[model samples]
Target chain A: DTAVSQTPKYLVTQMGNDKSIKCEQNLGHDTMYWYKQDSKKFLKIMFSYNNKELIINETVPNRFSPKSPDKAHLNLHINSLELGDSAVYFCASSLSGNQETQYFGPGTRLLVL
Target chain B: QQQVKQSPQSLIVQKGGISIINCAYENTAFDYFPWYQQFPGKGPALLIAIRPDVSEKKEGRFTISFNKSAKQFSLHIMDSQPGDSATYFCAANYLGGKLIFGQGTELSVKP
Candidate 1:
């Protein structure tokens, strides 16, 4: 069974449109995170949720928002996507905030034209 | 600084050769160091990890050598194979802090 899973493996949309990505983990972890990877393959943390509570929100734009309905689910909603928003997004989960290892999902690729 | 610096943005190795990737960190509070392997179109998976207390940790063909005083660590792949071709990332984590990853090293094993 996949430990962490994200829906909409690939998305292509026009600029100024809205999109959302859903992430779910079955590892029974309390901490979940969202990360963005740019064209240069640089990964940066975007947001973090621990036990359905927002903890870390990096220097992301207001158009990007992460919502955690529960401990097992965390979704990202992007409003008015721009050309620069095209990149790969990853979702990960760990047992706790201090867990050494994080299980990652198969990333979602978004393209804005 | 909370950064993990990785060297050799890309590397090519023979099937039986040894591949080495290095990483350095400025944060002394980072207690755990892990190496993650990522294939194309897939997420990164933890391969091996080491703590600051240990100078070296070996698992099968993969080994991690750490230098606490220098705040540097490295990953060594012995007898690398074509199947080992992938991107490798080095990350640092404190006890209660988030993990910071290196730029990443893309390894291509030639058969």
Candidate 2:
């Protein structure tokens, strides 16, 4: 069984458009995170949410927003996307914050054209 | 500055050989270090981890060597196999929650 899952394996949108990526985890974890992997394969954390409450917010742009409806679901919404947003977005979850092992989804590859 | 720096952006190893990847962190407060492996089109999965209190931790064919004072860690894969080809990332957990990941290393095991 897949512990973590993400929708839209690939996304291609024009600039200034809006899109959303959904993630779900069945591991019964309380902390969820959004990460971005660039062309150089540099992985960086975008946001972290614990028990549906925002915890760590990186220096990401305001157009990128994360919404966690519950502990099992966390969605990312990007508004007015730009070419710079073209990268792979990964969704991860852990038991709670604090360096626990994180289970990651298959990831959503977003390409802003 | 890159908090966690990984060396060898890519690597090629022969089957049955050993593969090594190194990482260093700037934050001395980090206590938990983890290694993640990602195959093609897959998300990163936890492979092995170590704490500052221990110098080494071995799990099956994977081993992690940590140097707390130097803020450095390394992952060693023994008996490399074609199925083990993947990208490896080393990450340090600062103060518990936030994880700082190193630049990934793509390892290809040749059969």
Worst 10 residues of 2 chain A by lDDT: A95-104
In terms of docking quality, model 1 is medium
lDDT for position B3 in model 2: 94
Residue pairs whose backbone atoms clash in candidate 1: none
Give a tens-digit lDDT track for model 2, residues B1-111. Answer: 439999989999999999999998887777689999999888999999888899999999999999888878899999999999999999988755678899999999999
The 10-residue segment of model 2 chain B with minimum total lDDT is B92-101
Best by DockQ: 2
lDDT of 2 by residue, A15-103 (tens): 99999999999988999999999998888899988999998899999999999999899999999999999999999998864445778
Q: Per-residue lDDT tens digits of candidate 1, residues A26-105?
A: 99999999989889888888888999998788889999999999999999999999999999999999987457788889
Q: Write model 1 residue lDDT over B1-111, tens digit each, in one string.
A: 989999889999999999999999998999899999999999989999998999999999999999999999999999999999999999998545377889999999999
Question: Looking at model 1 chain B, which ten-residue stretch has the lowest summed lDDT?
Answer: B92-101
TM-score of each: 0.97, 0.96
Runs with alpha carbons beyond 4 Å of true place in candidate 2? A97-99
Clashes of 1: 0
lDDT value, residue B81 of candidate 2: 98
